[model samples]
Target: MKTNLVANCHKAITNYIHHTPVLSSSLINDIVGAELFFKCENFQRAGSYKIRGATNAILNLSEEQKSKGVVTHSSGNFAQALSLAAKSIGIRAYIVMPTSAPQVKMEAVKQYEGDIILCEPTLEAREKTAQDIVDKTGATFIHPSNNTNVIIGQGTAAFELLNKHANLDAIFCPVGGGGLIAGTCLAVNSHQNGCLVYGAEPFEADDAYRSLISGKIETNDTTNTIADGLKTQLGDKNFPIIKEHVSSIIRVTEEDIIEAMQLVWERMKIIIEPSSAVTVAATIKSKLLVKGKKVGIVISGGNVDLAKLPF
Candidate 1:
């Protein structure tokens, strides 16, 4: 829970994870009326920021734990991240992916040499399958966004961002299970004063926003947004940190999400998934809030299915 834990994680996985570039867009700044710094985690290994946490989690495991292997249930980025990290570290990875997960992501996991366990497309089924794997193989289960090590690992992205741009007035990130934003909160608090942290969430799956208001975790009745990565509900581990440190959760529409994704692709010439665009969409939606300020937008990942693009 200490901010210094992020520093430890960075040191542990420095050789393994990429210190992703922080790029700016003059046009985006003009549009949002703020100087925007985009932390391009899309270019990160495994094409997402999840690798930071995945690598740190694996590296922190004891030799015996490493021998037994690590497991996680993720349909997209984290599945690939854990697989690649484990492969790089010479440990086995057990990935429990829902059958409805994109074929491209599943293939990427396989490409990383993950042992895939396909299950029904339900949270219950995924968790049960992962637990079964742990029971049978004694593999350690790493929750994608809820584990302490994972959260500390994720904070390294913001830590890097702040290391390069220490004077940022604010930082924004997309919220799903709350790991990224929660870690970001610790990063901003540890590194700078008066720098706020905000979370962008899809209106279709605004559990984080509602959870903030309700002072408890909330679930979605249906996740019908293009931002598949932001559909998951907040977890107890990350929700407390988010509720304590995040300034607010801005909900953006599906159309806005697509527009933002298209803008980054066309203007920045960078490929980003719908989840990554939520921060941009929210920034644009709340232009006045960030006007005349220096803001950092954590582009969560770029693991989009090109063949199934919304734009």
Candidate 2:
């Protein structure tokens, strides 16, 4: 909520998470007619920026709460993040994953020593399963993006980005449940001079885009986008922050998402998940707005199932 809270979170999780690299591609810059700095969170511990928030959330728990352990429902990166973060702090993690979630993500959660609870692929099922765990085990349920500590923790990525380059004209992030972009808005506004925050969302699942215009949270009837990580709707906690801080939300098509993913893999030689690629696709789609400016792109994660490449 406050800049100092984010700074304190950074201090708490400094040794726990990676200060991921900021990379730039000349070819990419030329293509967009802007100097782009890509914060490569794909190299982060647990292979995503979720670790920042997950670690912070775990570390902030009291001794009593820590004894009860932690639990969350995530089908992808956050599942892996909470597992690894809790393991690092010698706490147990309970992960409720949908049966339809990619096998690779489920396996990664196990690899990090998280206890997995498989449930039907529905929001209701996932939440119910997680709540059952909390009731039975007394574990605290951590909402992936809605928790205040998680939001502050996620802000660290942009904090580090602005620390390295303070003159960015804008920072772009892919919005799912909206933690990353909400946190990003706080960090950039708190630390930098006047860098604007922008959100990238898939047209197929543009709840955040619509929510901003409607002045309330929105949901999608069907999530038919390849950017699986951005399929979730914005939470109440993060929606207000995003509405106040984010400059705009750019909705990109499925084709543009694939093209952007391929471009990063081919040109930057980085393996970014489709969710991460949405930011690049949005940036490309709004080339004129970013032209002759310094831009920062937050590559949210690199966790992808190799067998399911959308190329």
Candidate 3:
């Protein structure tokens, strides 16, 4: 993807999306021995950066496509994101969520007026269900992470971050379906300052890390990580960008994720989901990599079940 794609996307969605703040904590900075800038997308619309891409994708759709509406299979942030984005534009949103998804997540989509189709808790089921909706209703299928407009939208978060802190030595983000990190890679390329992009993933669900090493897409043997959002593997659309531009993928243990989440909550007094915490955990785990540098961490989301928090 070109840098202009991300730059233009940020400009296009500026009015529609929140310009989330970059927060810092001196205590946490001291612990990591680096000046850490947290791009707090946890405070973003739909409670995650997913809304930026979701909004961009829908806004770019043709009038005919908008008339038929849109459909996607996501049980997490993207479901709510597409629902809210489509709702904002007065279009119908069909969200296919897995039966095993948390009831709270399903309720959140319903709150946004998304018509939910229940399917078995498998990627195959989710894809087939979403396709069935597209076949029946002619709704455009917007992939959560692989769509080009969506990647450009996701890049806007880091684009805004780099615009505000162009001097950052490197930026780290949690990797899942790879949209955000791939977008981040594109955003970093726009700056002449040579800011590098890194992805933080859980050891339990480290397909991204393994994929980088194997030089092809890799799947997780088990989706057993506490960072539920990072369980998905990379896609053809984003994986190429990741392979070319991302500096590396850092793997952190489950204990590291929990400790990092607790640290952010206690020190920064912010509620970050485990996926967001992976970036911080990676920074802490690889302290020497960022020592004495100005580093940016993308806090991806804050939507967590309060009753089942890891801590």
The TM-score obtained by model 2 is 0.98
Our model 2 lands, by Cα RMSD against the true structure, at: 0.9
Computed on alpha carbons, the lDDT of every model, listed in order, comes to 0.92, 0.93, 0.93
lDDT of 2 by residue, 39-138 (tens): 9999999999999999999998999999999999998899999999999999999999988987888889999999999999888999899999999999
* Deviation in Å, model 3, residue 5 alpha carbon: 0.8
Measured over all alpha carbons after superposition, the RMSD of each candidate to the real structure, in angstroms, is 0.9, 0.9, 0.9
Query: Which residue pairs show backbone clashes in model 2?
Result: none
Better of 1 and 2 by lDDT: 2
Query: Each prediction's TM-score against the native?
Result: 0.98, 0.98, 0.98
**What are the per-residue Cα lDDT tens digits for candidate 3 across 75-173?**
999999999999988999999998999999999999999999999988899999999999999999999999988988999999999999989999999
Instruction: Give the runs in model 2 whose Cα sits over 4 Å from its true position.
Output: none
Worst 10 residues of 1 by lDDT: 1-10
